[model samples]
Target: MTTITFTVSVLCLLPQSALARWACVRACPAACTCTQEKSCSVLCDRSGLAELPKEFPCEASAISLEKNRLKFLSERAFGTLPSLKSLSLDHNNISFITPGAFKGLSNLLELKMAHNDYISYLHTRAFTGLKKLLRLDLSDCNLFSIPDRIFIEQTALKELLCFQNNFRRIPGAIRGMENLTHIYLERNKIEAVAYNSLLGLGSLRYLNLQENRINVIHDNAFQDLLRLENFYLNDNLLSDLPRLAFRGLARLKMLNLGGNQLTNVSKTWFGDLVELEVLYLDRNQLLNIEEGAFENLTSLITLHLNSNNLSTLPFSVFQPIYFLGHLYLFRNPWECDCSLDWLKQWMESYKLVRDIPCAAPPSLAGLDLSQVVFPAVNGTCVEPAELNLTTASSETTATTENRFNSLISKLLQQELREEMGNGTESLRNDTLLDSEEAQLAAGVGGRWTQSVQSLLCFTLTWLLFGPLHLSDAGFWLYCT
Candidate 1:
């Protein structure tokens, strides 16, 4: 009687949560497994099924139907699971999605339909009721175009991946997705970016448009993306960037323009991109950079100008980018001459890296430019006449002073030789005069004695040596 009473009590409480649990377990498909821990999760992948498994739990929160033979998603296919938050239909043969296929999935936040190569058709209202969708991946879909209204009701969508498509132009289809922050459209057949092609994507922050056949970017092509930060346009056929191509992007921080045929860079191409920090312009045919080209890029940090044909650069060309930290100019034909002197000085002063070799002038060929001294590589061009004028004048004055001193020394030596010769001759003549004068003064001792000495010496010197020695003999006689 107690057991019967307990069974009745259990039946009485089966109408609310217990009844729902019992129904979920009974409704699970034979080919699918359902688990109801926090939320009902279904696993129906690789089931060789031709369609979505029948009898899915009504409150299923996550479902995986990947690797199935399902070819189409018909309308209202998943309408019973209004609580579905994640769906994976990848690796299926799905080629079409009929209108309202996911109409009642109001709480769906993530969808993974990637690797569905046969999926070439999508009805306009296929994703109509997914109001809370946040991420969608449709990569490798082989799509030629997307219907503009396919995401009409996905107001909360934030990220989308459409890589490996054949979009020849920027999709103007997703204009109203204002909340989108990331979009990957790489590896497309895009040939041109028409004006206002990406309109209404104001909240977009990261965009990847690399690996395309894009050759022309019309003016104002990126006009509506005001908050965009990172833009990748590498590996394209772009030969030039039209003025105002990126006019509306003020907060952009990084840009990649590598692998193109750009022959020149102009200041007009980077119109007021003040916040840009990193830039890549390598692998191009750039030959010239006009003066003041980087005057507006005040916040630039790293610059890549490698693999170009730049032969020279002006001193003030990089003066505006005061905060620039790294610069790459390798694999270029740099003429190491007078024009590069200032560049050499600046490189040493900033201690910048030298990653390229000189390709001109035989002496500096194949040499690391930073290791070379500019003045030694190319001699100073100062005029020799002006530099040597003072030295030449001083040397001339020195030569004149030495010649005058030599002449004065020679005159003194000649006078000393003549005085020595006169003294020796006078000593011999004075002895003879003294002997004669003693005899004369003893014989006649007065005015007649002096007269006799003077007369005798004057006559003897005149007879022996003419007028040159007579004046000397007269002085000797007077002394005796």
Candidate 2:
């Protein structure tokens, strides 16, 4: 009888152990993979799931439902995943998110819903329970504007990415999110930056508004972003800016204004950005930069001024930037003359200066300014006689005409030398002139005559009308 009783106890223990093993296997939802080796991680990605799967392991800390066919997220969709810290629903067809959709994800730290192009409407209370959410990605969505209170429960949120959307302006919903650090809104339709758009985001560090239609930025629009560091406004439609548009941003480091319609740089715009390091103003219509425009940027290290319509820069513009390391000045119509003599001297001390190709003074047309040696007369570098026509007196007009002819002769000689170097037979100066003078002389003389006449007309107009008309007439003349 004792042997039989012991055998029965062993049989009962076998069934109980098998039941426990079966329960463990059932904890993971169908077609989902779960692992509890480190922390319960559930992955149902690319599983053809049309809706959120139920019966996720109770201890699940991370879940991925990416690359699914989920269309709508109903209320309490992710029901009470108490230990859930991260959830990814990216690359799905999710369009609507009902109120309280994420109701039970209180401890959720990161949520990704990116690449959901159908997600246009978000209920105000959709993210009602994600209080501890630190990072939220809603990028590449069809969101035109977020509801004002959509982020009311995300007080601990730090990073928000809403790039590649149809947001016409900075959403008012993110105004008071003080703990927010980084905000990316690139590739949007945001037209203007109003004063109150970024009211209370004090802890913000990085803000990207690249590839937008931002034409107007109100003065003091960034007044509340005291701790802001990197600000990118490249590839916009900004032609002019308010004098004090960037006031109160003393801690800003990198400011990018590349690919815009800015005609000139203003001295008053960067008065408070003392700590700025990198500045990008490339790919614009910048014809002139006011003196002392970068005087306050003492700590600047990198400056990009390439791909503009600039013919020359003021000598004092870069004097204050003592720590400049990388200077990009290519693809500009740089006239290599006495005005740019200081740049050659400056380039000697900074070996990393990019090549600047000359665009004027036919003699140095295609030569790099850094490689061209300017002749010094009486211990001073003089502007080429051809470029000094604007100041030529009536008595010197005959001499100016002779110098212009000489310049043309020199250009022809240079072209003949290049041709001879390429194994073509060299021709006499008179022979070349007879053949090429009509073609080259007419083009060169017309340009210089037009330029001089325009310069004289501009000077006379400026003197007669004063500075009021300088904007319309004088600025363009000077730039061209």
Candidate 3:
């Protein structure tokens, strides 16, 4: 009787143990592959999935649903995936996301929905429970605007990618994300950067606004981004910039302003970028650059001035940048004149100088500026006559005044000698008393005319030697 009872108890224990083992071993979702190499990962990519899978392994930490046909994300679509850390939904046909669609993904760290061009409507509470999310990619979506407060709960987000969209302006959703470090908004239709549009994002370090329709940037637009480092505004329609557009960005390193309509560069635009290392002004309509436009770029390493309308740069523009490494001046209408002699001299100290082609002075046209030998006239550079006049007018007014006075004295002495030679016989016939009375009367009149003459002299001096000085002999009529 005792043996029979023990046999029955063993049989019952065997069935209970088998049932426990069956419950512990979960099955992978249909049409999905599950692996356990490093962690539980599920891949359902390119599977023609029309909707979210009804079940997923509870231990899945990462899932890839790329290249699928998912049209929308229903509420709580991913039911209670507590261990989910990374989810990829790239290259899908997803168009809408209902509220609380990601509510059960409490531990999701990264969410990628890139390449979904039809994703246009995203509820404000679509990402309600993803509080610990770090990176989110919504690129290649045809989104015109992002609902404000969509990321209000994503407090720990670090990188946000919204490139290749139709956004007309920066989304107001990322205003207070203090921990965000990078923002990629390239390839959009953003027109302008309003003042304080990026306020309160103090920890942001990288911002890309390239390949857009941006034309205007308000003053103090980046004032609150004190720790920003890399900024890209290239490939836009920016013809002008506000005085303080990049204020408070002292830590900036790389700045790209290439492929724009900027005709002139201002010194005040980069007054606070003392830590800048690379600057790009290539492919612009730049005709002039202010003196000292790069005076404060002491840490500059690479500079681009290629494909511009510039003929010559100021001598002192690149003098303060001692550590410059690469300088790109190709495809510019460079006039190889004495004004550019300083550039040739400066290039000798660097080993990576690009060949500058001469675009003026038909004799030097098609010649390399570095190889051209500038003729020296009397131990000074032989510049054109018109260039000489420009240099003289740039001098101080005191120097010009002295030169005018010397010329006037010489002319007056010549006139007096000519008059005396022609009237020598007439003067001898006249009485010495007549000459004395005439001298006394002339002296009195001279005092009265002296003040008036001085005023006229100064005015004529400016008209002759000022910026608008004439190059012809017609100006001598004013002196007569």
Q: What is the C-alpha lDDT of each candidate?
A: 0.76, 0.83, 0.82
TM-score of structure candidate 2: 0.76
Candidates 1 and 3: which is better by TM-score? 3
lDDT tens digits, residue span 1-480, model 1: 999999889978776666666666777888888777777788898889897765578878899998888888888787567778999998888998888788778889999999898977677777878889999999889788888777878888899998997777777667767899999999999998877678788899999999999998888778888999999999999988886667767799999999999988887777668899988999988999877778878889999999989987767776687447998898899876656767677778887758768776665787777755543314664222333555577776566445434432433333354456754454344433334333433333234345446456545654565433212444454434
**What TM-score, over all chains together, does every model reach?**
0.71, 0.76, 0.75
* Worst ten in a row by lDDT for model 2: 466-475
For candidate 3, write residues 349-392 as lDDT tens digits: 67577779998877678988887776676789886444555656
Residue range with the least summed lDDT across 10 consecutive positions in model 3:
439-448
- What's model 3's lDDT at 41? 81
lDDT of 1 at 445: 29
1 or 3: which has the higher lDDT? 3
